[model samples]
Target: MKAELRGLPKDLAEVVAGHLVTAGMLIDDDPELAYRHAEAARRRAARLPVVREAAAETAYAAGHWDIALSEFRALRRMTGTDDFLPVMADCERALGRPQAAIKIAKEARHKQLEPALAIEMLIVEAGARADLGQQPEARRLLHQAILDLDDRRAAQLGLPAARLYYAYADVLEQTDRPADARQWFDRAARLDAEGDTDADERRDLLDGMSITFDDSDEDGSDEDGSDGSDSVEGESGEDESDEGESDEADEDEADEGESDESGSGQTRG
Candidate 1:
């Protein structure tokens, strides 16, 4: 936090650092609280791009779509870059504004984006298409996006290719193409060792390892317990939980020796 805040004055840097510490600590376990801390940092250091980015990411994690979109817009204006367009567009989609999301995606400024960020925008745009009942278009866009990826670059970008496949598979299933869905889901699972998305669970459901059953069975429902064949929904609750990957494209970009650049007494990107 201190390194990222070095662009600010020393006094305000400490303040932002303290709030960022709180935000980072809570971001995974309690994202709402994390977002509060991030907003505090944003209030104190709204001029700094990193602070605004922190607030934007945490707000997105907490499902505060309106606030996230606002903060990302602020970040874009401050940085004069579209590095965050994918997340920003996704926030629009989350707010029940798919057309707005699509419009953001179609803007020409994003042509300058690095490959990973561009791929992320593709995923977000495909998701918006799905929201608008354009599954076929969504699947076609994602197919082109995957084909545009380089294998080595995909490996360096920390599993975006896997996520693209997952997004395509999800749209395929939604459009009632189960066999093709399974194929894409298989590709996603093979690439995603970290389980950053729910590809594994989706594959399992398609393969019928996951089952749904009535809970009111008198013969097997002993004291609300169950036999091995049919258990309650949460007995293995992985299906109910979201993977919360949100976006990872920036992580690939952020890994480019940021601390080393900050050590030279300036921020890069």
Candidate 2:
């Protein structure tokens, strides 16, 4: 269908097709550029629902949450399909409207969406609930999603699984469960390792683990200086050097005072 559409010689078709391909190429490397292409496509073919969807996706990828939301809302009205609900919910979550995300996800769930999409909705729902301080509800939702995925043998959705784990880790961290958060983060890292190897994803996962371990070491050191005994010893050595300097200054002052007193006595005599 895409190839047939691209084969058309009409100026609108050419512009739309060109922009669509360009938008996809720019999505990973430069989402802002992708958004521009998608916008161009929309301007060229305002009547095309797919063009609008592309624009919404590009906007969301570029972190323009408001623009993405507006485009998605327009698309939703035009198509009345639940295909983009997960992305819409993600935009809402990013914009700090977690409750709105939860509502959207609930609608998606009622529509009997695809398993991956449904799981994504559940993840967003959990996140929103967590943000609103509904801890038990959030946990229940997350656990339900996890169990559903497990039953479905959805490790095939490794990327989404990794994202879900990272989200769980974020929530745990916010709730002051650093140890548990680290475990989730570790899971995310392992999942990423097992999945596709995009350069950016690999770098992010590796860096995340490195930072986590570094932070753990720092925290452990603070709790029990045994972890940083070398650092402590070095600091102690510096302190001793400062004390020795102070002692030398005190002796120098005493010697100066004695010389002044002796000179005064000699002059008086």
Candidate 3:
């Protein structure tokens, strides 16, 4: 508000400041109200680029995809910036215009964006692929995104890492690979310390849904043809291993060591 209201009359700046403050306060817990506040600010000072940006992001948070898209385009025009491309493409996806989303992504791919924004565009493109019944392509896109992050200075991709692993796990679950999905979900859970995702719940659900099988010889015999009680105990013990803990620990360290603190650019609700 300070910058955007720089040339405004004192009374007008005060009103806009109040609205923007209220919008920020409610954005996380009451997005509809926050959007209303943002709208008030936008209406009061429609010519300010920052005010328009606030309106676009608030509209997105409120699930008003069309309005968000329009405002984002306006922001692009005002600021001559391409950073908002991911959110714009995502709006296209939400509006069931996946082909349009794909076109936007293609055009933005070669443009220079921050790493976090780049990952967001990649995710939006992958989601658009899913919308087109191209789950394999979507999975492939996410998988390559993870590999790309690993190939780069991994220490700079914190937000993207969490989102990539979580998205990949979701695709794997949809493809009926629950075990692999569980592994990636665990990785995502460890990386997402802010609890931005439902990773822990997903992993817990997978654990509860898992089925245990006996690998003993037929006739209910162990290796030596003894009663299968020992085999059952062994299988139960196998389930009791610290594998999950160790895996989470290792992945957490890797995530912490490699990722920068930059946030993912998407507006979430």
Candidate 4:
């Protein structure tokens, strides 16, 4: 990003860079403010692809779908790259243009994108299909993407794999396959080490009830409302200990009786 801004006057570049930095920092929590910062940067340096890209992403984060789409389109034209295709398609989806999103996805299929970008395209296309009530088509698309995943990549359990698993799991749940959905959600939760998706919470809700995933330290006890088998075993073990103590007490009493008889006989002697 600094390299991209180097073409501008130093003072103007500094200002624009500051806005971009603020935009990025707030994009996840205060997206409206982030969008404002991005827009300010774009107003100062609209010609820069990096500025436009920041504006496009912040607009998307702020739910300014039309602005996001326009900026992404401009970025694509300026850079002659299809790297932003997934986000542009998602903007179309946000604008209630599922057909346009699908079109963008189809066009993207012909381009050579990074693996993560390709997976994102599949996710957006599947979402568009679902928006059109083509649940089966959505499931097919996501399932195919899952199947096409690079084995090494999938094994890495990176964000891309987690996202793909999450999308597939969501489609399965929507299609009324709770068991299958739960399994995939479990996979997603495991892969999403960063908690980017709510896969853990989603799996716990497969039974139409929320089940909080236990993050407590393990004491061989179930805190997730499971059948309490461990608790029962603990109780049984306590019972056995009590019975053993009772038997020991009886033996001690008999030993005392034997001692008393022996002592009485010695006294008699």
Candidate 5:
């Protein structure tokens, strides 16, 4: 077994060494540092497809979009495989070319990438469409993504599910369906909360819904007061009671806001 291992290729050995170095840098929370290691590995194993792919991924994570795109493009040309298409799309999106990203994502889907990855590409396409104000196309893509998730046997889990629901909520909100958006936001919040994934993001979504509810209440109250003032000549008991309740609610909201601020300060400290 030792002799057989020793006979293993030098190129593979260099690639493995690069992976280890890159992984170490990644573990240190330094993507830029890791990217250097990956680049070195890519240089040493230029003919190795896996090394190029790893280098591209690390470069992308390091926010070296130009380098990542170049590496991915090279890999695609060399292998003629769609495996790197989504990564290319991500690079394009980061570079503010959402339409290009959408196109690449579609090509990835055409190549029949994994269902999960395909769904992600669809989500990206939808977001790009939405950014371009193609609301109908965005909604259609989102609906298809939801249907795909529903048909899957595995229970939707983790960041992907959270993100999908969040995206759906955003689309609903953009379409002026606050009630439906709130439902989807609630679902996303619950999923993220349960998974312990970026609890602050989930909290923000819930807080936004709370603010929306407060705004709706205020608008309704103002409309009712205007109608009552026009119809009645004097201050009424019902109006007095409504004013008292509104004052209480405002005080409660103020207290909650203070508590939230205090909690955030403590967390930061």
Candidate 6:
């Protein structure tokens, strides 16, 4: 990045570099602020690929999809690589142009991309298919992508395996295949050491795991038990007695309340 900035006068380059550094620092925790920093850098160094890439990423993180799409498009043109296509397609998807996203993914498929980028493209394309109500086609696309990947390499290469599995599980759940979805969510959770895909939470949800809150009055002076406790919270007898009934209620609530995002974002390598 510093090398790219060498074209500018020394003082100007230092200022732009500082903005890029600040953007990178704030991106994960405060994306809007990060985007402001990145925009500051881009305004001064608009011709640099590194600056454009920073701007594109911060915009994407801040949920400014149109600006992200435009900046990523500029990065592609300047860098002469297809590295941004997956994210660009995703930006198109976010803008409610699923067909445009699919078209970009189609173009991406013919290009020689790295393994991770290829997987991201496939994932984005599958999502676009789902958005268009082509659930079966979406499932097939992700299924084939998973099949084509080697499991060992997926684990060792630090690939987006968890996201892939989570996306598949999400589709299965959407399609009313709870049993299959749970299985895939379990697989995703196993690979998701970083908790990137919320797979563990999803699997627990499918398993009907939940906490039962004691809704007794805060005065701690309600409910009946053989023991002299104010509430049933400490009554192991009542809890044990109601265990089976509680399980049914939990399952019902899980079914009605669980909502999921599409999938994890593309790994920002």
**CA lDDT of every candidate:** 0.76, 0.68, 0.78, 0.82, 0.63, 0.81
In model 4, what lDDT does residue 102 have?
A: 99
On residues 43-133, what C-alpha lDDT tens digit does candidate 5 reach at each position? 6666666667768878888899989999999988888877677678878878888889988876775586865566567777777888788
Candidate 2 per-residue C-alpha lDDT over 187-250 given as tens digits, one digit per residue, 9 for 90 to 100: 6667776554332333333222111123445445645443533331111122112233554564
For residue 157, give model 3's deviation from the true position in Å: 2.5
Order of models, best TM-score first: 6, 4, 3, 1, 2, 5
Expressed as tens digits, the lDDT of each residue in 40-154 for candidate 6 is: 9999999999999999999999999999999999999998999999999999999999999999999997999988788888889999999999999999998888887777976
Clashing pairs in 3: 155-258
Q: lDDT score of model 3?
A: 0.78
Report the C-alpha lDDT of model 4 over 19-89, residue by residue, as the tens digit. Answer: 99999999999999999999999999999999999999999989999999999999999999999999999
Give the higher-lDDT candidate: 3 or 5. Answer: 3
Any runs in candidate 4 off by more than 4 Å, and if so which? 207-269
Q: Report how far off residue 197 is in candidate 6 (Å).
A: 1.5
Among the numbered candidates, top TM-score falls to 6
Q: Residues 1-269, candidate 3, lDDT per residue (tens digit)?
A: 59779889999999998998888889899889999999999988999998898899889999999999999999999999999999999999999999999999999988999888888898899989989989999999998888777634544565567787888898888887877887888888877788888887677555532234566545565566335334211112333223345535644743442211211211112
Query: Candidate 2 has what TM-score?
Result: 0.66
What lDDT is obtained when candidate 6 is compared to the true structure? Answer: 0.81
Per-candidate clashes come to 0, 0, 1, 0, 0, 0
Alpha-carbon RMSD to native, per candidate? 16.4, 16.6, 13.2, 16.5, 12.5, 8.4
Q: For this target, which candidate reaches the highest lDDT against the unseen true structure?
A: 4
What shift in Å separates residue 242 of candidate 3 from its native position after superposition?
25
lDDT of 1 by residue, 1-269 (tens): 55668888899888889998889899999999999999999888887787898898899999999999999999889888878888888999999999989998998344688766787888889999988888889989998877777777667675778888898898888887766787788888888889888887787556434456655555665553424335313224333222452224324433552221122211222
lDDT of 5 at 237: 13
